[model samples]
Target: MPGFDGACTVNESVKIDHPKLVKLLQLAYSAEKAAAFAYIGHAGSVRNPDEKVAIKQIEMDEWQHRETVLSIMGQYHIPTSRYYEIKYHIIGRIISCSCYVIGWFMPYYFAGRLE
Candidate 1:
């Protein structure tokens, strides 16, 4: 949206094409799946019951987000990819391992950088 829009065309009726949305949704779906996996690993590694529960809840939220993206893909008649799912799962595991090695500060640092 930021890159596409040049000037503010509030009066103009511009509809984004299906393909762009589909691609964006697909990426989002993959990311959500990866995040959920990472959260599960993080939750498993934690000793504090409350923190573990919180991370698991976050994992559930990510799963729900994935489902939402899946629903949108269905509505658009876009096919899901098994390959991407497995690939992202592995990536997520790698991320989880990195976080484990870095400890709690890693997430916060990354969050700040991302923001």
Candidate 2:
């Protein structure tokens, strides 16, 4: 359908075996998997009523993303690990992502950029 956003995309071709393609795919897959787990953990820990609902919705999205990643990996017979070790680097990433979201929206909420 026309004007369906990404339902149809430009058929721009690129080499599938390109290193950059592989790197980007790996990054996206890792982020989705991490987000799924993080949302699950947060959903379990959150106590506020409205926040609980919002978190659950976000968790569902992350779960869907994880499933899509695994489905794509399945085509290549790639293994998707359910038990990967997380290091301190992940904690830093978590903080960074949180900060990014807060930073992006806080200014809009405040109606001005914060200095």
Candidate 3:
């Protein structure tokens, strides 16, 4: 390998031990869950069949990302933060409900901003 200095064998697994990095990943995990919840409402609110399918796919992708994040956390022996779990769940539900009242455009706009 170009950057290899024979420090360790390629088969050795690298572990992440940084607290801040782990915390950030935890945040991402929760955010993905929230986004998935929001997408549920997003998909339901839209009338177009194609748009519904697309939003559902996006929702699935968010869930997949959340799983991947959880797997990473497990590797690091990191648990999900309880406070964040509650906070984002509420935020996600709020966004989901708002999607219905405010119409489609604002939700799409806010989602873009969040990204």
lDDT of 1 by residue, 35-99 (tens): 87677667767799999999889889888988998877776677677776777777777767776
Cα RMSD for candidates in order: 9.1, 10.7, 4.0
Candidate numbers, best TM-score first, in rank order: 3, 1, 2
TM-scores of all candidate predictions against the true structure: 0.71, 0.48, 0.81
Off by over 4 Å in 1: 1-17, 107-115
For each candidate, the alpha-carbon lDDT, in order, equals: 0.71, 0.50, 0.81
Question: Which of 2 and 3 is ahead in TM-score?
Answer: 3
- Local error of candidate 2 at 83, Å? 12
Better of 2 and 3 by lDDT: 3
Q: Model 2, range 1-115, lDDT digits (tens) per residue?
A: 6667766555544345565655445555666655555554454455678876886787577658757866666555455443332432274246334533454342223211100
For residues 10-110, could you state the per-residue lDDT of candidate 3 as single tens digits? 54445678989978987888888778878888888989999999999998998999999998787777889888788778878888888888888876765
